[model samples]
Each structure stands twice: as C-alpha cells, then as structure tokens.
Target chain A: MQETRLDTARIRAARQAIDPVFLDTPLYRCEALEPGLGCAVSVKLETANPVRSFKGRGTELVASLLAGDGRNAVVCASAGNLGQALAWSGRARGLDVTVVASRSAPAAKLERIRAFGARLELVDGDFDLARERAAALARQEGIRLVEDSLDIETCEGAATIGLELADAAPTFDAVLIALGGGAMATGVGHVLKELAPGVEVICVQPLGAPAMTFSWRRRRVVTTDSTDTIADGVAGRRPIPAVLDDLLVVADDAVLVREESIIAGMRLLLEHAGLVAEPSAALGIAAILEDRDRFAGRHVVTIVCGGNVDLDAYHRWIGAAPAHRS
Target chain B: MQETRLDTARIRAARQAIDPVFLDTPLYRCEALEPGLGCAVSVKLETANPVRSFKGRGTELVASLLAGDGRNAVVCASAGNLGQALAWSGRARGLDVTVVASRSAPAAKLERIRAFGARLELVDGDFDLARERAAALARQEGIRLVEDSLDIETCEGAATIGLELADAAPTFDAVLIALGGGAMATGVGHVLKELAPGVEVICVQPLGAPAMTFSWRRRRVVTTDSTDTIADGVAGRRPIPAVLDDLLVVADDAVLVREESIIAGMRLLLEHAGLVAEPSAALGIAAILEDRDRFAGRHVVTIVCGGNVDLDAYHRWIGAAPAHRS
Candidate 1:
C-alpha cells in the first residue's frame, strides 16, 4: 500500500492556519445517549461554527492557501455544505468564489451560498456533472479548481478535528466518522492512527449512497448509477480517486446504514443532544444505532458534523411514522 | 447602590469548580444575521452543553458545594431547565434531588428531569406556588433548599459565562442577555460591568412577563398577577429579592419585547444561525430586531442561552405564518 500523504507535522500546522471559528468545537459526553447505547459516547460538535458545519475547516485552509499563492479566483462543485463553506471562506480572504451547485440543491443551503457573497451557478445535473462544469470553468484565466476530497490541503486541514479529539478524549476505543467525499474520514483517521494507534477509525456511509464504501471494499474507484438519500451532503455517485487512495491507507473499517436509520439518528440528535444535525452528519450515530452490540461497553466518539437541515424537511422527517424495515 | 456580591474573584474560582461541559461554549460572528440587523453581532452559544441550557453551570457548582458541605439531599422548584440541570448535577455528585414543578411545565422538559434521576413533584399552582411548596419541603430533615436566583453560589457559577465572553469578545458596545429569574442577567452583567465597564449590559424580558423589567424600572421587587408568554423559561410572576438586588447594581437597562417578536427571533435563529434556540434564549435577538435603529453600526453580543424546545413545538412555531405586528 502507498504511504498516506497526511502526517502529524502538516496537521499541526494546519491547526494554526485554519480559521479560529472552526477550531476547538465542544467535545462533551452525551449523558442522554450513553445509557441507551450501553457505552460511553463523546460527541465532537462541529455544528457550532460560523457556517454551522465542519466544511469550513478544510475550505478555509484551502482558500487561504489560494490567496497566499496570489490566486484571484477559485471554483468548486458541492452538494451544499462545501459550496457554502468555500463561499464564506473565500469572501473572508477577499478571493472570488464561484460555486457550481446541482439544480436540486436544497433551498436553505443555496440561500446560504448567496448570502456569503459567492457567485452561484446552478447546473441541471447531479454533483458529478457540476464537478465537470466546475473543472471546465477552472481552465479560464486565473481560476483555480479546488475539489473537496482530492485536495491534500483540505484533508490535512480537517485533520485538526482528530487533533482536538485526541487532546479531549484520548481513551476512546474507536471513532466513528460520516463518510461523504471521504476527506473527513481520511483526515481524522490519519491523525488518530498516528496519535492513538490502538484506536480504530470507522467510516459510516448511508446505504442509499454507498459509493465510497463500495470503492473502499473493492480497493478501486466505484461509480453508482443513482444516489437516493435524504443525506444530500454524502450522496455523491462517483468516488474521487485521491479520496479513495487515502481511504485505502487510513480507514480501518466502513459501515453502511439504511436511510430510515439516518432519519432516526437525526431525531435522536435533536431530542437527546439538542442538536439540529443535517442527515449526512447523522450517519455516524445511525451506524452505531444500527450495530449497537459491536459498540456496547466501549468508549466511542462520534462527530456531529453539520446542522443545516431545512425546517420543513426536519419536521417531516422527525414527525413521520417510522418506516417498516424487514 | 449596594455593592454586588458577585465579584470577579468568585467568578474565577467558580470557573475552576464548575463542570467542564458548561464552560467555553462557542462565541462566533453571525454573518447571515449581521447584514439584516446592520450591526456586527457575536453569539455566545450556551446551548451546546450537556443540559442544552446555561443552567448546568450554576447547578453544577451548587451541587458540588452541597456535596462538600455533607448534604445528602436538595430540593428546588423550576419551570423546566433548572430542574434538569440540578438533576443531572445531583446525580453526578451522588446527591438525591427532588424537583417541585407546576403542572403546566412542558412535557419535554419533565421527561428530561426524570431521565436525569430526579424525583418530580407536581403542584397544581403556578411557578411561584411550586417555589412555596419546595421551600416547605426544604424544611424536612436532611434536605437543603436550592433556589435558582437567590443562591449566591449559583449566581457566581453563572458568572463564568461573563468571564468567557469578556475573554472572547471584549470590544462589544453592549451585551443583550435574556432575563429569567434574573440569575443569568445578574451573573453575566455583574462580571461584564467589572471587566468591560463601558460596555452596556441590557436585560431582555418578555412583555407578557415583565416582572424583572418592571422591578428594574421601579428600583424594587415587583409582582405580577399572571405571566403569559411562549418563553416559559423567562415568564416569572415575581422577581427574587436577591436577584433584583444584583440587577439593580449591575444591569444598565432593561427592555420588554412582544411575544410575537420573540417568535420572530426564534425563527430567525433557526433560519439564519441554524440554531434551535428556545423562545427565552431568543430574546436578545428579538430585542435587536424590534429596535434595529438603536444597534445600527455598533458591535453587539447576544447570548443564545438554551436549546430545550420540543421538536413538535419547534415545527409549529417556525412553520406558522407571521403575526400581523405593526
């Protein structure tokens, strides 16, 4: 296996370079959740930041580097969270940001992107098509294309979350992370493996969009015909090559949770943790709920990554009757 | 005016004695909120703690002191959040806690109080009557009365929030705090006045429950016949003597906001900041929105102090059409 690009030294520096608003979020033990799961669970709250998501850490670091390199403009394609992060971070650094979002992107997230003063381009396609369009736009003069999972700086920046967890709760038996474009899992996994070598790093993906999980299992990039999940943040159809490469080296295990479980996890977070987590960010909790016996009597940590759910959708998802699962 | 009992020295010690879960919550700028309000606003998010409210800080400190003084049991009367805080803190210290609550207490909060291992006693009267019953119960053998705002230790513990805000954002022109039994306002106001002397400390109360506000304006304790508002946390019928004393010394001004404005603030927090703040916690934002002309071009800080709203109620409140407010 090829050596991982993320290291402790780079992660330490990224911790300093990233914006302060995105760093050192609260990592506390969830009293309401521990008894039911029969384990000690610590939640790292990433939703408390300016953008209400963990995407700002990686996007801010990447945007700062682009600014330092004298780049005038940057382009990216996102489901929602990444676009908002890039737009906010780019505006902070006085760099122009153009986000290519799928036409089906949630209105709440789209509003945030425009609110951050970033130019938004809606593409009549999926996330992959938006990425293709962003790539083509990057070829224009003085434009840098920054992909979420493929960018090494973005991954290293996200490693700061691992550094924080290690400092806050070093005795965890394992850490559960939501897998989207794979930067979160790869970055956090790389640092935890180095600092807490005995701690297992598990990646969780929604069953509706298991592209990254399938690719990790097969040891190759995989593309799905369709991605159907309420977790729009993690519903990518194609896996990025660099993200898959990093996952192969860093992730110890991967689990898939049903869509219904994800919705249940979202409600649990709101009811117990007083958190308003988007569907994608709740996958880690969903994974633990789905396989409770494996985590029983163990010290575990899960990242509550984002809280950008639409109010209407949140009400519908939480209030709806539980779907019958065979 | 009499010297405030809540000094910076006590606040500093309380910071060390209090539970770490309630300390150093996120203090960040709200980009989406700033443009509309025409002022730079920073939010101190107290809802991120385990209890999902600022009550944990005061309750934890008081509980520890009770344990140190060889107390075996304690009794308190609360509308909701305080009971949960005491129950959780009491359990941590191995002290039995009995909470006297009114029948009108939110069911969601009652469930949490029980979940934290507290004995609940329902009274058929209002919050003040519940307090009277709790005071009588404290006369029992081996039971101490733990009053929310009257306890100097509880106020001192809550003062740690002022310490954190002073350290985090000291340049604010004014700080808007939600007034509930006057403990939060008195505690935070006391410290901010000492540290940031020029920064105005404004206390916000619902127009329906103007006990503290009326008392502050009258320069003495005031009682109201009935308290009616959606912000159950702050809807107190009478002001505690000790709390009113502290507020007289520390609070610069007090304002009353309409119930409709409070609802608007709650919705704004959810839509703009992605925070699920309870109605009481949204008072600071409500004050700003109701009188936007006063805060224009100024740096202000608002404490989003709690996130204990029920999901069903949250949906109903946010989904409802805007009331015709002139």
Candidate 2:
C-alpha cells in the first residue's frame, strides 16, 4: 500500500466545517440488542438527521469546500444516499448539483434527492455506467465531479465518526463498518487506527457484493461482475482503488455475510433495538450474527449508517427474516 | 387556572442544568410523510437518547435538584420510561433510586431500570395503584417523591422541546403532543404559547385513555375506571389536578384517536419516515391521520417522544397495521 496520506488533522478540519445538523449524532448503548449480538454494543446512529443517512456528513463537507472554489455546479453518481446528501448540502451552499443514477435506484432515495433541490439525470445502465455518464456530464459542463471514496473531502468528513466513537466512553475492542464504496470504512478505519491503535477495524460486506472485502484480503483492486443484494446502499460492484489502498493500510480484517443474515439484521435492529435500519446499515450486526464467537466477550461498536429503504422492500425483507425474538 | 404559575423562566433555567445528551435533540422535516399527513410535518425525535424517551430530560433535571436539597434518595412510580429515566439519572447523581411499577409494565423497560441500578418494587395492580404504592413507600422511607407532571422541574425540562422547536425553521401552525399525564403537553404547550403565541398546541390522547383530554376541557380532574390501549407509555388512568389546570391554561385543543390509527401511525413512521416510534410517540401522527382536514395545508409539528417498545407487542402491532405503503 502507498505511504499513508490520510491524516487525523484533515478529519479535524472537516469536522470544523460540517453542518451542525449532521454533527454529534446519537452514540448510545444498544441495550436490547446486546444479548443477541453476544457483545456490549454501542451504535453510532447516522440516520436521524435531514437525509436519514451518514452521507450528509461527507457531502456537506464537500459542498462547503465547493463554496469557495469559484464553482457553482457539481456532478456525482449515486445509488441514492450520496445523491440526497449532495443535493441537500449543495442547496445549503447555493450550488447547482446534478446526480446521475440508474433507473432501478430506490424511489425513496430518488424522491429525496429531487426534494433536496438537485437535478436528477436518470441513466439506463448500472451505477458504474452512471458514473461514466456523470463524468461525461462534468466534462461537458465543465463542473466539478465528486465521487465517494475518491474525494479526500468525503473521506475526511467520514473520519469524524471515528473521532466521535473514540471520544465515547465505550472502549470498543473492534468496530465493524459496512464496506460500501470504501469511503466510510477507509475514513473511519484510518482515524480509529490513528486515535486508538489498539482498536481493530473490521470491514463487513454482503456475500452477494464482496468486492471490497475480497480486495482488502488481496491488498489490490478487485471488481465484481454484478452485485446482488437488498443492501443496495452498500452493494458496490467496484471498489475505488485509492480507497482499497487506504483499507489495506488501516483495516484489521474483513468479513462477508450472507444475504439472509443481512435481512435478519435489519429485522433484529427494528425488533430488538427499536430503531429502523436499512440492509446496508445492518452489515456489522449481520457479521456478528454470522460469527458470534469471534465477537463474544468483546466490546464492539458498529455504525448504523443509513435508514432509507423502499417500503415494499422493507416489508418483504422483514417477512423473509426469522420471526420475532420476543 | 390559578393565574398561570408555570413560567418560561423556569424552563429556561432547567435547560442550564440538563445532561448534554438530553439537550438539542434532532428536529427535522419529514419529507416522505408530507403527502400522507396532508401537511408539512416536522418531527422532534426525543427517542434517540440514552433512555429512548423524553423522560430523561425531566428526570435528569430533577436528579440534579435532588443533589442539593439534603436528599440522598428518591422514589417514583413508572410504567417503564420514567423508571428507566429516573434510574439512569439517579446513578449519575449518586443517589439511591427506588422505582415502583405495576406487574404489567413492559419487561424491556423493567430490565433497563434494574440495569441502571435502581431498586424495583413491583405491585399487583395497575399503574395508578403503583403510584399509590410508590407514594406510600416514599412516605415510609422519608425519601423525596418525583412524580411526572406534578413536579415543577419535570415540566420545565419538557418545556425545552418547545424552545428547540421554536428555534427551528418550518414554523408550524399547530403542534401536537401525546398526553401522558399532561407532562409533555403542558410543558411544551406553555413554552410555545409564551414564545410563539400564534402557534396552536393540540394535545392528543388515545380513546382508551382520555382522562387528560376530558379534564382539560372540563377544567377539573377526570378519573377513569380502566385504561385500555397498546400505548402503555401514555395510558394514564387518572389525571393529575395540577397538570390538568396547567393544560387548561396552555393547550388550545385536545383530540382522542382510535387504536387502529395508533397502530397504523407506527407503521407510517417505519414505512415513510423510516422511524420506529412507540404507540405513544405515534399519537400525534395518528391524530393527523384521524382528522386530516384539521391539519391539511398547514405546517404541523409532532414529537416522537419515546421508543421503548416490547418486541412481541411491536411485531403483533406491525402485523395488525395495514400492509406496505410502497
């Protein structure tokens, strides 16, 4: 891996520029979910804010950066969460934001992106192709292109989570984060490794979409043909190369969890924790369920990253999971 | 109304001494639920804190006061949220806390109360009898009794919600609160009346527990022989006279919604707003569903006041409510 360029100072500076709404999110003990997970768990809930996701922290920081760059327009490709975050933050910073997404992105997120005052450009292909199209638009329009994990600002913004979790009283033995495009995993992993060297950063991904997990194990870029998972938020077909390099230097371990466990994880959070979490957000909890002994008797922390899900999908997945614990 | 003794000054003062966790909770616009509710809706989520309820704000404030009053012990009657809140705050204040609760209180809450290091005394009958038992225990032990809504500090703590809502944008034409012994309603209603006099405060209660609504309208104490509702958090059998007098002066309207709507409201929050609200927390949203015309075309605000739900009951209610929205 390349010599580490990610610094804790950059994350501290990012925290200084973030919107107050996205800062100081609820980090509390998940008392009800502790017994089932076989560990004392404290969850950093990133869903209760404006966009119902953690994307706001990074996107808002990036938007603030664009405010002074003599730029009024920015383009990005997203499944949904990043688009909503960019749109919300862009509106606050008076930037004209454009989001490119495939036709099959969740309507809930698509609607939110538009509601947040961003121009939506629906593509006829996958998120990767959508990214190519977004780049083409950025080139054609001469606007800034912001991609998650590729942008230093995005990574630094997510690092604030590590800062917060470190300050919390629970001295977590390990932190399990969902491996999406690697922005959150890489950012948080780097900060935690810097602040608390003893803490292990475990990156978790869906078995159906194991690009990042496989890449982290191999210490190189690994791209998958097609992703198949209900956790669309974290189902990345390709891991950003830079993000993978950071993950190799910072991440302690990686695990792939089954699709069934992911659905059960969402149900577990709602039933046991009394909070709603989307499939991607429950990746860490799914990892624990998949291998409880690995986390047994250890204090663990997980980020409930996003809570945006289509109602039909949410209900169907809840029905597919095992019946109530209580 | 006894010349309106409840003052905003007391609420503001209480804010100074609150635990930082309980202050400045998430208050944001619910974009997805706007169409369903027929108005712009903002939700102040009081459930995201340590106690998973708004009771912590009041209990913490009261605990701080108890620290200086030559008191080392306190007793209170609770269904679950209040007991857990008191126990958590008492532990922080280094006080001996005894909680008296009925046998029927939620195990989720009871377990948390015990976990927070409070002595739990379970009674045979309903919550009213539990309150009587708690009062007797307090008298026998010569300890201070902290009753929700009856104590000035408790009401003042809740009033901070109104202060926060007033500070936020998306100004509301009316604010709806679940009437649980009139603590939250009386507190928030008083503050909103003082700060933003144009904003109307509408107190909502379940049809099964209409004591507060009836008493507020009649300007007297109203007692019910039985309270039958799934929203055990706000199921008050008898209205406190002092709370009723305060509500009579502060609240502009009171509405009682059916059980079906309450369950459906919970479903609505999970589906549209992506939140898991307790039956009582969903009270305001249910009221909006019942009388859509009353809130149509007007910006409305509601409090998701608590989220401590029994998993068995939560699953059953989710099954009972109407199926998926998408």
TM-score of each: 0.94, 0.90
lDDT of 2 by residue, B1-326 (tens): 23455788878888878887888888877877887889988888998777899998899889999997767999999988999999999999899999999889888889989988999999988888989999999999999999888988788888889888877634678898999887889889888888888888999999999888888777788788999998998888888887888888889999999999998898788777888888999999999999999888998888999999886677677663323422
* Chain B TM, every candidate: 0.96, 0.96
lDDT per residue for candidate 2 within A234-287, as digits (tens), equals 877888888888888888999999998997788788776777888999999999
DockQ scores for all the models shown? 0.37, 0.35
lDDT value for candidate 2?
A: 0.86
User: Model 2 compared with the native: what TM-score?
Assistant: 0.90
Worst 10 residues of 1 chain B by lDDT: B317-326
Please write out the lDDT profile of model 1 over residues A1-326, one tens digit for every residue.
Answer: 24687877888988777888899898887878776667788889998877889999999889888889888799999888899999989998999999999999888888899989899999998888899999989887448998888888778878899999877555688899999888889999988887777788999999999999999999998899988899988888899887898898889999999988888788788777778889988888888889999998898899999888776776577763222211
Off by over 4 Å in 2: A1-7, A67-72, A92-96, A117-119, A122-125, A320-326, B1-17, B67-73, B91-96, B114-124, B319-326
lDDT of 2 at B184: 88
